[model samples]
Target: MDNYRPVSFWFDSLDDPVLDLREPPAQVDVAIIGAGFTGLWTAYYLKKKQPRLQIAVFEAETVGFGASGRNGGWCMGTATGIEHMLSVPSLQAEGIRLQQALENTVDEIERVCQAESIDCHFARGGTLNVAGTPEVAKRSQQWVEHLHRLGFKDSEYCWLDQAQSEKRIGLSRNLGAYYTTHCAAIHPGRLVRGLAEVNRALGVQIIEKAPVFNYTRVPDGSLLLSTGRGAVRAEKIIRATEGYTESIQGQQRSMLPLYSMVVATEPLSPEIWQEIGLTRRETFGDGRRVVIYGQRTVDDRLVFGGRAGYYFGSKRRALIPATDKAVKIVEASARELIPALRDPALGETVFSHGWGGLMGVPRHWRPCVTFDERSRIGWAGGYTGEGVGASNLAGRIMCDLVAGEKSDLTTLAWVDDVPRRWEPEPIRWLGVKSIEFFGDRADRREANNQSAGIWGSLFNRFVG
Candidate 1:
C-alpha cells in the first residue's frame, strides 16, 4: 500500500485506504476488463439497468490504479478533436446533440456524487482557457465566435477581456480568456474511489489484482477471459483498458499510449492564493501548442500538468529521467504564469508531488466507443487523455448498447467508428516521435517569435 503511494499524488492522498479483493467467479453475465472509471462506470450503470445481471470487473491492479485516479482533475465536457468532429456539415445536427449530451454528462456525474454521498470536492466553477498572449487572445475571440456560429449559445462559451480574465483567475500576461461553464474541477482520486464504494453497494463484484492475459471465444459463443488463475467465461465482454490496450495480445496497435507528466504544489497560504487567483477552483490553461492544464485544488494546492511524450511500441516499463524533466518544466511554467510561485520566501521547492500517466490516442486522434452485436465483444476507449467526463458518458452509452436499448447516444458518430490500425513498428514509432518532436519545435518557435517552418506545417497536417 505504501508503495502504491509513489504512483501518483492522488493515490498518496487517499483518505480511505481500505481495499476489497475478490476472485473472479466461474462465469458471469458480463465481464469487463480494467477497473478504472470506464470499466467501473459501465458496471455501475449496467447493474442499475438490470439488477439481476451478474457482472464482474477484472482488474490487473487495485481500483483506480490507472489513469482514472492520476488525471489532472478537470472533468470538462469535451473530448479530443471535438471541435473538428462537430464542424463537419453532415455531422452538424448530431454534433449539437453530442455536445449537449457531453455537457449534461458533467451534471450527471455531479448528480451521482451527490446522490451517492461522495465528497469529492467537486466545484463547477467552469474552465478558463487563458489567452496570455495577444496571438492567443485573437484566436480565443475567433473561437467563441465560431462556437456561436456553430449553434452553441453564448451561455456555452464566452470571451472575457484582459480585466475580466484576471478577475476570474490571476494568470500572467493578462490578455483575455476563453471561458466555458461546461467544466468542473474535482478530486479524481475521491471520485473514482467513491464510485467503487457505490459499485460495491450496488452488487458489482470488483476483482482486484486479477490481471487478464488474453481472451478467447468459446465454441458456444460465450467469451472466455484467461487469467493466471483460470478462465472465466461470460456471455459478453467489454474492453475498458484505455492506454493499457497494448497489454492485450492482439491490440498492440489499437490504441497508442501517450505519456503525460504532472506536478502539484504544496497547499498555499491565504497570502499566496490572494496573489494567484482561482478562488472558485476554475481549471485554467493556455493555448499553447504543446498543451498544458492546471487546477486549484480545494485545499489550495496548484495541481498542474502537461509535459508529454510518446514511447516506442507503447512500452510499459519506461526509462524515466532521474530528475524528471516534467517536474522542472511544469514548475517553470507554473511560476511564469503565477509569479507568487517563484517567491523566494517560500523555501527551495513548493512542488510536493510529481507523477505521470498514459492516455490512449487512437490513430485518428478521436475517441471510439463500439459494440458489435454479433461478436458480443465490445470495447469503449480511445480518450486521448480527456477521458474523465467522456468515460462517464461512455458508461451510459455502453450500457444502452449492451442492454440492446436504442437512444440518441447509440447512433452518434463515434459509435462503431473503429480507427484503422497504426503502421507497423518502426514506422509507428517514427511517426509518433516526429509528432512529439515537431509539436515541441512548434511551441518553441512560436515562443521565440519564429515561424514553425515546413516541418511544423507537415506535423499539423498529419495530426489534424
Candidate 2:
C-alpha cells in the first residue's frame, strides 16, 4: 500500500458522476465556497425557501471530497457536549432549547432524505458510549448525572449496565454505557452525493474544482471571490469551508484542523458476526479522553476511527490517507476494544480500507453559526468531529440568518458565538501537541486502572 493515499471507504464505494457547471454565472444571488455538507445543505434549503434566488456552490475539489465524505458517518444531533452547552450562563435556557432543536434536526434529516429519495442506508439506531475501564465508567456515570440534571429524559438518554451494554452491542468488558436515541448511521458519501443531485435538480449550480484563493469587498457592496480560474461577484457569500478554512488567506487562526484516521475490516463472516454483533447498527465508542467512533456498515463491515496525527504551527494540513503507522494505530485500538475481533481463531485481522480526514476544532471548542448583515457574509462550522448532523442544522440556521428571519433556529445558543482566535505560531503548536500528548497518556493510565492525574482534570475543566 506504498502508493496508498487517504480515500474513505464511503467515497471508494461511490461512483458519483462529475456534474460541474460549465462556468459560474457572471453574478448570482449567493456564492458559497466549499461544497461539503454545509454548502450543499445550505444551497438545498435556501433554494427550497426561495426558488427564484440564483445559488451556486463552488468547491475546491468535488462535493463531499473533504470531511463530509470521510467521516465515520455518525448522524448524531450533538455538535457539542452537554457540559459545553451549559458553559454560557446567559444562554443556559437557550442552550437547552438548542439541544431540543438538534433532536428535531435528526428527524428533519430523515424526513428530507426520504422525501428526496436518497438511499443512504440511514438507520435511526442511536449510539453507545461504552465504558470498558473503571476510569471511563466513573466519567460515564458523572455524564449521566449531568444529563439528568439538564432534564434529558430516559427516552432521550439513559444509562445501561454491564449486562445491558453487553446484550445491546456484545461488548462484555463495558461496565456501562450511555445510550442515546437521537443519532443515526449513514453512508456519508451516498448522502452527500445524493444531496448534490437534489441540489442540481432544484437548479443549484455546483462548480467543481473552483478553488477560491481569496475574496474582497467590491465597490458596489458585493463580494468578489477570486478563484484560480476566474473571479465571480455575488451579493452574498457564505464561507462554508470547515477543516479547509486555513487554506483561505489571513484566516489560519480562525480554526484548527485536526486529523482523524479510520480503518475498516473486510465484511466479517456469518460466524464472526454472530460472535461479535452490532445487530441494530448502532454507532459505538469508548469513554476515553481522546475521541474515537465506530459503526457497523450496512454491508456488515466494522468501520472504526479515532483521532490520530496532529500537525504543528504553520504545518496544519489535511492528511487524507494518513501514514500507515497512524492508520495501524487506529486499527489496533479498535481490535483492542473488542477482543473477539482479534482472536487468533478468527484468522488474520484484515482491514480492507484505511483513510484519514481533517475536522475543524474551534479554539474555544464551540460550534458557531452566524451571518453578518453589514458584510453580507454568512457562515457556519467548528463542529469539532460532529459535523454529520450539525451541518444540516447549520444550513437551516444559515438560511434563517441570511434571510434576516427571526426563527427558532436563529436564536439558538451557538449563533453568533465567535470563539477567540488561537495564539500565534509556536505557542499554538506547543499547546496543541501538549494536549494530544496528555490525552494519550490519560487513555493509557485509564487502561491500566490508574488515575488520569492533573492533566486529565485540567483538560476536562478547560477543553471540550
CA lDDT, every model vs. true structure: 0.84, 0.84
Compared to the true structure, candidate 2 yields what TM-score?
Answer: 0.95
Which runs of model 1 end up more than 4 angstroms from their true locations?
318-322, 345-349, 450-456
Given candidate 2, what's the lDDT at residue 395? 96
- By summed lDDT, the worst window of 10 consecutive residues in model 1 runs over 316-325
* Count of backbone collisions within predicted model 1: 0
List per-candidate RMSD values in Å. Answer: 1.9, 2.3
Q: TM-scores of the models, in the given order? A: 0.95, 0.95
Candidate 1 colliding pairs: none
Tens-place lDDT digits, model 1, residues 1-464: 33567667788787645655656799999999998999989999999999999998887778888889889999988887677756677767777777888899999999999999988899998999987666667778998998899878788799988888878777667688999999999999999888988998999888877778899998887889997557899999999999888888899899888888788888888877887788889898887767889999988888998877777767863323315776677778878878777777654447888888888889988887888888888999888888899999999899999999999889877788899988888998899888878887876765665666775687667776
Per-residue lDDT of model 2, residues 306-362, tens digit only: 975667764544445535678889988888777768777866667889888888888
